[model samples]
Structure formats: structure tokens, C-alpha cells
Target: MVQTTFKNNAVTLIGNEVKVGDVAPDFTVLANDLSPVSLKDSEGKIRLFSVVPSLDTGVCDAQTRKFNEVAAELGDNVIIYTVSMDLPFAQKRWCGAAGIDAVQTVSDHRDASFGEAYGVHIQHLRLLTRAIFVVDTEGKVAYVEYVPEATDHPNYEAAIEAVKALTK
Candidate 1:
């Protein structure tokens, strides 16, 4: 169980963080293209899941671009998506300005249903804490990392290793 503190108060996540071998919860998010995309849509492919609070921040922006660059090297077999509470327009603009073309940017502004389902929602902040989950082709989680602090970056090296393991 991971505990997160916001505004000096700590809150516990209701469920265990999604872990290796656990089936990822299916989600419907608005893509940068403004199309509804679900976990089912990316089934049968290696997924690099990057979940962040918002795209308007420096860390979130860096995280998305870094993943986009890494995704290119991983090729078409691996699909990467960065999720946040930003609107689709903002996400699209950020990606464009950053020249991030390899990774898809998705939004959870509608209800944050995806964040709640993944147990990454920051109750008090109304934002998502940085987290990552790598779901294998069979839909089982291969790796999961919920950054201890909302202001920190996720473990990118470990996430990349997880994706590499999936390709083996």
C-alpha cells in the first residue's frame, strides 16, 4: 500500500498499487486526437504507461518527451501513452511544441475515472501522483511504480527494463 501526502495531510490509497502479474484495469481516455482510447485498444502490444498529474508542469513535460524519445527506439511493438488531467487541446499543443511524436498523450479530465481505477488519484489535490505501469501483451502488468512523492519523477530506467523484458 502506498500513502501520499497532500497539503501536509497523508491519505492512503484504497487498493494495493497495481503490480506485476495483476491485470490492468481497462480505461477509456481522451487521446490527443480527442478520440476515446481504451486499454483494449492497445492489447497485444507492449505498453509503456506514464501517468502524471498535469502536462502544464516542467517535470510532466520532461517525462512525456523522454518517453516519446525512448518509444521511438523501442519501435512499433511498444506503444506509449502519457496520461494526465489536462484537456486534449493542451496535451496536443504540448506534444506539438515539444516535438513529441512517438508517444500518445491522453487526458482524464472528464471524471478522472482512470486515475481512481488505478489508485493514483490524489484525493486532496484533485490531481494524480506520478506513476507508471507496464502492461505486457497478454494484459498482465509487468511493472508498476508509484513515485513516493507527487513532485518526483518515476523510475524511468526500471520501466524501460520492464518493457525490454517483455520483448524477450
Candidate 2:
């Protein structure tokens, strides 16, 4: 239950706080095809869960694209999941348009599974606050960054560094 804000106004988050060393919470987010995707689907891989409110925004777009590029450089064992409350169709369209193949866009719009599970769900907005979670190959959370402001960008280098740690 981490408290955050959007443009200086308080917003409530609804879920357990995810910390380093904790077993990553399982969540069912929708793929671009509207198929269910969960942590188990990418088991045994280092996962970078980049949670954003919407891909269409400036910060969120930059965040996703940054990970997309990093994902391309990371080896096959590493996978990036971009979770958002946007619909699967929108996510697919945005990814295709932006040429974001390295990162997979997952939708939590249907049920807020990923949002709630990751403790990023905004009480009033029903959108996920900005955050990043790195899960090692063993399914343990290696790092987490819950951005204090919804409109602010996350610490990109720290998140990437965490993923790099898992790869090594």
C-alpha cells in the first residue's frame, strides 16, 4: 500500500508492496492478442516489468522505447514486459507504430491484475503509477522503483542496472 501522487495530489495504491528479495507476485495481464500472459509464461528468464500508465503519453512512450532498445541488446535469456492499463489493441498498435519489438506490451485494462498485483493501481484514475520491477531468473524480485509522481519518469539507469545484474 504505497502512497503516491499525480501532479501533487495524493493517490492510493491498492496492493502489497513489492520489495527486493520477495518472490515476484503472479499476475494475469493480456497480451496484444488478448491472450492471458502471466509470470509463469516467461519462467526461468530475467524479467524487467516496466509499468506505465499509458503508452500514448510522453513519459510513458519514452520509458517503453527505452526498454525496447535495451531489450534488443540484452541476451535471449532476458525479457522485458511493458505493463499498462491501455487496451491490448492500443498497445499492439502503439508497439507496431513505434517498432517496439524487443519489449512485449501487456494489457491490464481488462482486470487490473498486473496493476493490483504490482501495487501500482491508482485509486481514482484506475491507471498504474509509474514503476519498475526487476525479477531474477529464480522469480525473486531483485529491484524495484516506484516513482513518487505519476507524471515523472523513473530512474532508467537503475532499472537497467538491475536487469544487467541478473544477466550476469
Candidate 3:
């Protein structure tokens, strides 16, 4: 399992670790409108998932905002999603306040489906550790970054590059 820490404190992560070239696992998350959204819902598009503990936090907010700003440039074939354990209502409210229309904010609060599927569930905290995953158009994981520190930012450039490659 990949080791993760929040504020230097080790946290147990459940679920199987995902690696590059692996078939992207399908998981259900709630859209801001409370509709169930699965990985298959966005079939044929390169998808980038920005997993975060919570959007209300500093790093998570910045991470989502950064991705939102770049979504348009990523082309119409790529969709960026910011997944969190926050409630759907909370996700909707945060996106509104942050003007995060480019990136879709999905909620895993119902069952941690996305967290467990992607191996980002912070066992004790019930929050997802920071991570980034770029799935190619064919549903293969092109790049995976499980941020060692939950409070830190992910490698935005690498993840973005992965999506750009898939678009080309």
C-alpha cells in the first residue's frame, strides 16, 4: 500500500493501490445535483480526477481552482473532476463561491465509493488523501500521483501533461 501522511501523522489507506497502465476502476460518485455519476458516464473522454480531503481546506481549494483554470485549455475531449467526501450540497456551494465551473466537483459522502475504488480513502479520517489520476480515453490510467502528504499539492504539471498527451 502507498504510505500517506496528514501533517506528518501516518494515516491508513484502504483499497487496492492504482498504478499507471492499469485499467481504471469504475466507481460511483454524486453529482452536485444528487445524480449518480460513474466513470463510465464520461466514456471516450480523457478524465482527470483531483482527489482531495476537502475543498474547504487551503490546499484542496487551490488544487481545484488551479485545475478549473486549465480545463478550457485541455480541450473539449478532456474532463476534470474534483472528488471529495464532502456532501453534494457542500460541493455545489463551494463551486458556486469559487467559480469552479470548468471542473466538476463530485461528492463521495454517500459511501466513499470513489475513495475505496481509487485507494485514496483515509481510513481513520473518513476523508480522501490528496491524489491525482489521469485516465486516458480508452479507460487506462495514464498517470497516477498519490501525494505523500495530504496537506500538500499534487504535481499539477505532470497530471496536466498526461491529459494533454491523451488529447493528442
Pairs with backbone N, CA or C atoms under 3 Å apart (clashes), candidate 1:
none
Better of 1 and 3 by lDDT: 3
Tell me the spans in candidate 3 whose CA falls farther than 4 Å from its real position. none
Candidate of highest lDDT: 3
Candidate 2 runs further than 4 Å off: none
Q: Which window of 10 residues has the lowest lDDT sum in candidate 3?
A: 159-168
Q: What is the lDDT of residue 31 in candidate 1?
A: 85
lDDT, model 3, position 113: 92
lDDT of 1 by residue, 1-168 (tens): 777654345765533468778998897889877889899998899998898888888789889888987887786789998988899999899888888889988898877767877888776566777899999999998898888777777888999988998898
lDDT of 1 at 25: 88
Per-residue lDDT tens digits of candidate 2, residues 52-158? Answer: 99999999999999998888678899989999999999999999999998999999998898888888999789899999999999999999999999899999999
What's the count of clashing pairs in each model shown?
0, 0, 0
Off by over 4 Å in 1: 6-16
Candidate 3 residue-wise lDDT, 1-168, digit = tens: 899999999999989899999999999999999999999999999999999999999999999999999999999999999999999999999999998899999999998999999999999999999999999999999999999999999999999998898887
